[model samples]
Target: MSKAAVETISGESLSRIVGAVVGLAGFATAVLAGMTTTNPGSVTLGRALICLVAGVLVGRLLGWGGEIAVKEYLERYRKDHPEPEPPAALVRLKQKRDRHEQIVEEMKKSA
Candidate 1:
């Protein structure tokens, strides 16, 4: 298949990208907020790590769910609608093939 026809962002990849972005954002925010507190280094670090993990999980789940919902809706829509006709080129190709077959059969009968 052509590169353009290939799926660029699948459900899994989208989930991973969203998870990484959210995880980084949450980690950065937690660290910056923790910096202003009187909490010990270990506690601040712990909170930041927790936020990172939570953010990643939540973001990934949301992304995956959203992808599934969109695909389901599209599938339902497709089922409810009629498929389009074949392209003009394809129709022409089939007609040419039929003509070729007919000529071959006629030549065979004459021989």
Candidate 2:
């Protein structure tokens, strides 16, 4: 619910999208390379499938790398803004605790 949590979730989602795109691109590149470099006699459906799978795997790896980069960025941001604590459920809990304490003190004074 907090901005920090939102940012973290958004970053992760963005990384996944980037990864999928990269994988598709790698697949295309692999197909193209296979078509251009291999002999006509060597070309086969099985070989093409293998190339495609390999490309996708490479793309996924790149995507994971992207995710790591985003995580690093977030870590740096957290380090820089260490003061104003991230808005979270804990903040609300603390607020409630403080109000309860105040009420208890008032009741004691009245007694």
Candidate 3:
């Protein structure tokens, strides 16, 4: 194994990058809101944390929306350009196997 090779993102990871980005945006908004709402003498730490969490949640949802949209589009595109059907001989073999399975199941139940 070469330890020096550069790693590249796969198509799936590339797709989910949208989600990660959205999460970051959410986190930022949360932190900002938290920072703004605390009193002058109070510890803003709690507020900051609460907002940070909220931000992350928001970002995740946004990212998910994007990912889902992409996935749907890809699925639609693939459906329109499907792979070729399997050979008739292969289909026949599958049908025979299914029939054999049902017979085995019926015999087991009777026994």
| Top-lDDT candidate index | 1
Clashes of 1: 0
The residue-by-residue lDDT of candidate 2 on 2-68, one tens digit each, is 3332123456554455556665666566567767775562464446566556666676676667666
lDDT of 2: 0.64
Residue-pair clashes, model 3: 5
lDDT of 3: 0.62
* CA RMSD of all predictions: 7.5, 8.9, 11.6
TM-score each candidate: 0.60, 0.43, 0.45
User: Where is model 3 poorest over a 10-residue stretch in terms of lDDT?
Assistant: 1-10
Clashing residue pairs in candidate 3 are: 19-63, 22-59, 23-59, 26-55, 27-55
lDDT per residue (tens digit) for residues 22-67 in model 1: 9889999999999999988899999999999999999888767766
Model 3 misplaced stretches (Cα beyond 4 Å): 1-42, 57-61
How high is the lDDT of residue 58 in model 3? 69
Give candidate 2 misplaced runs (Cα > 4 Å): 1-19, 30-44, 82-111
Specify the highest-TM-score model's number: 1
Number of clashing pairs per prediction, in order? 0, 0, 5
Candidate 2's displacement at residue 75, Å, is 1.8
Better of 1 and 2 by lDDT: 1
